[model samples]
Target: MAVTTETAETGLVVRYSFLWPREHDRGEREGRKDRPVCLVVPVNVAPGAVVVFPITTQDPLPGRIAVAVPETERRRLKLPGDRPCWIMLDEANGDVMPGSFHLVPFETHPLRYAYGRFSPAFMRVVLRTMAEAIRARQLRMVQRER
Candidate 1:
């Protein structure tokens, strides 16, 4: 499907080059590699802007905020093999969609624009936890230009 702003909804999992906040802090302007990221705020929320939280198979280090992906959710995506994955809630990468340089189609499936979407109930849990992280001043943002 076409990855237009209208189709990029919250909970949608897309492969993206996510620039980490620490990387940005260190003067890096690009992400190291493409990885799965959940769309937390779609472009419609702030015209042209989208916020994506990173997904990783690695466990969260101490003091970091993250939410584990339930088995059902994992089954839905069929991702990360048998290893548990976590959606990092402590930070997000903000970029403009539809025209984002970092948002790319899967190399293995050029026509596909996304993996799948999280269930609405699970999405609510993600958003709520993210909001808490934001309120606690634990959330960091790396705004990507172009």
Candidate 2:
């Protein structure tokens, strides 16, 4: 899929990721993270149809959302004044904080990119790998302290 996540929009990217209707995470485990977050959004496209994504931006407490539908999918989601539904991002990674993201729809957003599928199982594995990376990073600090 080779999704090139922007350096500036990382936190918001995570925000997009959390938008799904809850298959994981606990009550207290949902909204905490290490830093700023990026949102990951999922669009429902009919088979053989392109999924149009509206890129949006938000803050940690996640109050405001500015969405710009992708120019490519603009015509798709925008059918006779019937634009796509609006959704807010959910916070998942408590260790990593979410950032304020400026979302532009896949059609209009200049930085638009494409790909396929987010495997929650794969994400979970990657998370475990991330935990190891964190531990290794901490080990260096421990050695310095020693």
Give the number of the best model, judged by lDDT: 1
Worst 10 residues of 2 by lDDT: 137-146
**Clash count list over all predictions:** 0, 38
Off by more than 4 A, model 1: 42-45
- Whole-model lDDT for model 2 versus the true structure? 0.27
Tell me the lDDT of candidate 1.
Answer: 0.85
Query: Tens digit of lDDT per residue, candidate 2, span 48-113?
Result: 111112233222234322223334343433322334322222222222111223222254554433
lDDT of each: 0.85, 0.27
Q: Cα deviation of 93 in candidate 2 (Å)?
A: 12
The C-alpha stretches of model 2 lying farther than 4 A from their native spots are 1-104, 109-117, 138-146
RMSD of each: 1.7, 16.7
After the best TM-score superposition of candidate 2, give how far the Cα of residue 123 lies from its true spot, in angstroms: 0.8
Give per-residue CA lDDT, model 1, range 1-146, as digits (tens).
54677878788888889999988999999899788899866534577677889999999999999999998998888765788999999989987767878876877788666888899999989988998998999989988898
